[model samples]
Target: MLLPFFQEDLVEAGCDEAGRGCLAGPVFAAAVILPKDFYHPLLNDSKQITEEQRNELRPVIEQRSLAFAVAQLDHKQIDKLNILKASFKAMHLAVKKLQAQPGLLLIDGNRFSPFKRVPHKCIVGGDGKYASIAAASVLAKTYRDDFMKELHNKYPRYNWAQNKGYATKEHQAALDKYGPCRYHRKTFRLDYSQPRLVTMTPSVNSLSLNSEVAVSAE
Candidate 1:
């Protein structure tokens, strides 16, 4: 079972991002402050679940969480600041939108750009270990997939509905056949021979929660 909170005395928000590895579409992030007692057997790392499961959990999380917000930075912003900073900026934007301010932030990844006065904890696989982080992951992934599906409607040739802009073999083949569209990331190495986004590491400022209980990286 996922831990409910890092500490007992403060409002905590779990944060995560989606679509960093995509060849196109905006990178999205979500900040979810779930109740201390929130629990769902299906909650886990977004990547570990199927599309159906993520979608199912999105509403459950929204209905149960204390406060939640989702935000994104598009291809232009990604190009201007680079994907890493854009991801951090997106996370910051989401955090700023929460109806209730969080005293502590549980960030899914190991690096973050820190949200103003709020402190944060970065877990290597936080979504699988923390209920709030898993909730954020569901929101981020489901919302990003929805955005990509909309983009797919206008640019069907890219098959974004299927690949969600990942560097998949089919996506590369499409880029080769029709070249890039207005939504494509011009700054990215868009070659078919290029590796997937998982091979990359984006640099950024680190964040950790105040009085956080540290768990070894998974």
Candidate 2:
């Protein structure tokens, strides 16, 4: 029962980000401009949906939306700007990739870094209240999950495929054993007292994914 548009006459892109709270992997954001008529009974906040439901809705949103783009800011950048600014930069990047310019931006959170000349309205839980924002939430979550799954392949011990880089007990246990990998945000307090576990650094080749630079779901 999300609202179709913030304004009936203007093109509006809903914005949302995922993985801002994770200890590893990139923070992903998405901008979606849906037609005024867009509707689906299953559409809602990404967190409200199951994995299968998110995956199922992803293609439907993409196919139906007027324009949609997903982007990410990696662990390196997150460490540089802090999670809040990084999340905003990721959302800005996603909006930059949109094929059609939006007259207004519907942001899911209470705060956002303004994007260019575009006006924005911040809704604390807009993802559950607006169609385009909910759609953006779905794309952001699913894309970040896929990226984390790929990273899991390279570092199986972290169990990223299962934990999706969250600070789960198993993930904390792995950090307690092997230390942080290149994929981990060093800024995060991992709470390991062993110097040996803290000494290891990721090799040049270990920073494989260019997720820190830019990621796009086109």
Candidate 3:
């Protein structure tokens, strides 16, 4: 039931980002400009669908969309700019790479740093409300998941393939044992003292200046 466009007369690109809540890996964003007639029953918010569904939609969105691009900001940049700015920066990078210029940007959050000359409309849950934004969500999540799976090959103990770098109990257990690798966001509050694991000890206090649980608005 997602709408096709926010403004029918203007060229619109829907923008969204993913991987914000993970303890490791880069944050990814995508911009998608769908055709006037784009339609799919499975097109919806990425969070509401299964991995298989998102993967299935990725290729279809790529081939059917008028223009689409995905981009990411690594942990290093994320630490430097903070995740919020990095997320927006990632979106800007994706938007800039689109083959077709967008007259309007339908962003999937309440706030966004303006992109060049383009105007934007921020909807809190825009991804579920609009087709292009949902398409962008699928692309951003799939691309980030692929990158994390590749990293999992190098460090299987963290189990990036399964956890996808989220602060899950298993992931916390890995951090408790192996500590943060280069992929772990240094600025993220990975407080091991958290009762998330009964055996969890304070391993990250020495690593991060802050030790609070870092929740992501992915």
Candidate 4:
């Protein structure tokens, strides 16, 4: 069960970002100030929920929240500033767009770039524990997913509609075939330290191991 607010005494906005680990597309963030009494059984980390669930929740969150806003930083920005700073910038932009000015921020990660003079607290996996953060996570993930799906039409080889721009083997295979698109982060190392996004041959056994290893490493 997710709680409504991090603190009862102060106005608080929950913040989260999506697509931070993707090799392509924009990193999106959301800030949501929900009523202290808000409750929803379906709410959890965006990653734990399905697309239909997130789509269903998005409208409800927008209509019911005290205030909410979503923002994104594109691949060029992520490549230029690096994913961490770009994610922070997206969060900052989301917070700035909120209709309600929160007295405090509850960010859903272990690290955060402070937003203005507002105080903040970072809680790892906070989205699964807090209502506002979960809502923000849902919004950010759904919005970014929608963007990727749109991009997929223009670049069908990446299969972004299915993989959502993550460095999946199929996506890497596409990279091997067609090379990195303009949407890919050129600065990100496809092999973790190569400083280039290039095709890597996967051994038959490694093909099965890749998903497990990637998830664990992430």
Candidate 5:
């Protein structure tokens, strides 16, 4: 059972982000401000719910919430700033897009960068603890997943539709076979302690800068 709102006296918005751990695709965030009386038996953390349930809740949330907005930080930005900063940036962008100003923000995670001029509360697993935050989670996850499904058509090798750009074994296999696609983050260690395929030789430490220079000098 989730709490309806933080307090009846203050206007509040819930904040959450999705795809923070994906190897590809954008990180999406959502902010939802629901009425004080908002209630739904099915509402909960997005990860704990099925895709069909999330789809069912999305329209209801959008139609019933006082105000709601979703935003995304693309793959390039995610690589430039790193995942942590990119997640916070997406959340802040969503909050900025809200039609109504909220006095307080209840964020799903245990850490959050405060939105400008608005006070915030960081609740660990707030998505399951608060109705508004749960609603935000549903919106963020569903939207991000839909976006990844669309990207699957452009690059079918990675199987974005199945893994949704996560660091799965099949994804790593694809990376090993074809090298990384344009969406792959250069800064991230693609070979994260995973053994290379038996047929592929590992060149992770074969090249030296001075050796290359000496070869060029020859």
Candidate 6:
């Protein structure tokens, strides 16, 4: 069973991010302030649950939580700051949008960039150990998966709906044949041998660059 809170008599928000390791799509983060009495037998780390379970838990978490917010940092921002910093920024943005200010932040990972004046505790596997962090993980993963599914509609060749923007073998094969669309992170190692895709004309390049966009769902 997951613990309810790290500190007693304090409003604590759990923070977690998803898609930081993906080759495409934005990194999504969620911050959730659950009720002190919140408890669910099925709640755990997002990775441990099936898609159906995550989807089911999302609405439950949102409905039950005191305050919850989701945010994302796009591929461009990830390339600019690197994935680690981008993940942190996404979490920070989520926390900023929360209706209830948390006295403590329970971060899922081992490291977190301090958010404003909030104190935080970094638990390496907090998602599995804490109820609120598990709830946040579910929201982050489900939101990012939904966004990637939408992107897949625009570029079906990449098979993003199935791979969810991960660097899978099929995704690499698609990159070899079609090169990369604007949504592909230019900083990531798309091609080990070639390193970079063939340069396109100014107009086409501009269009492709503009296509690399982020979707925000809160």
lDDT of 2 by residue, 40-141 (tens): 989999999899999999999998888998888888899999999999998998899888899999999899989999999999999999999999999999
Q: Which candidate gets the maximum lDDT versus the true structure?
A: 2
Superior candidate under lDDT, 2 versus 3: 2
- Steric collisions counted per model: 3, 0, 0, 0, 0, 0
lDDT at residue 210 of model 6 (Cα atoms): 35
Q: Give the winner by lDDT: 1 or 6.
A: 6
Per-candidate TM-scores read 0.87, 0.91, 0.87, 0.87, 0.86, 0.88
| Residue 208, model 1: Cα distance from true site in angstroms | 31
Pick by lDDT: 2 or 4, better one: 2
The per-model lDDT (C-alpha) reads: 0.81, 0.87, 0.84, 0.81, 0.81, 0.84
Per-residue lDDT of 5-111 in model 3, one digit per residue for the tens? Answer: 98789999999999988888788899999998999999999999999999999989998998998888888888999999989998998898888998999999899
Which candidate tops TM-score?
A: 2
Candidate 1 residue pairs in clash (backbone atoms < 3 Å): 120-208, 120-209, 121-209
Worst 10 residues of 4 by lDDT: 209-218
Q: Which TM-score value belongs to model 5?
A: 0.86
- How far is 163's C-alpha from truth in model 5 (Å)? 1.0
Q: Which residue window of length 10 is worst by lDDT in model 1?
A: 209-218
User: What tens digits encode model 5's per-residue C-alpha lDDT throughout 1-218?
Assistant: 99999877789999998999888777888999999999988899999999999999999999899999888877778888999998898888888888888999999878888788899999998998999999999998998788778767767887988898899999988887777766666667785333342233223222210111110000
lDDT of 4 by residue, 27-75 (tens): 8888898889888878899999989999999988888898988888877
lDDT of 1 at 91: 89
Off by over 4 Å in 6: 192-218
lDDT of 2 at 136: 97
Model 6 RMSD in angstroms:
4.3
Q: Name model 3 segments beyond 4 Å from true.
A: 193-218
Write down the RMSD of all candidates, one decimal each: 9.5, 2.8, 7.8, 9.7, 12.1, 4.3
Give the true-structure RMSD of model 4: 9.7
Model 4 vs. true fold: TM? 0.87
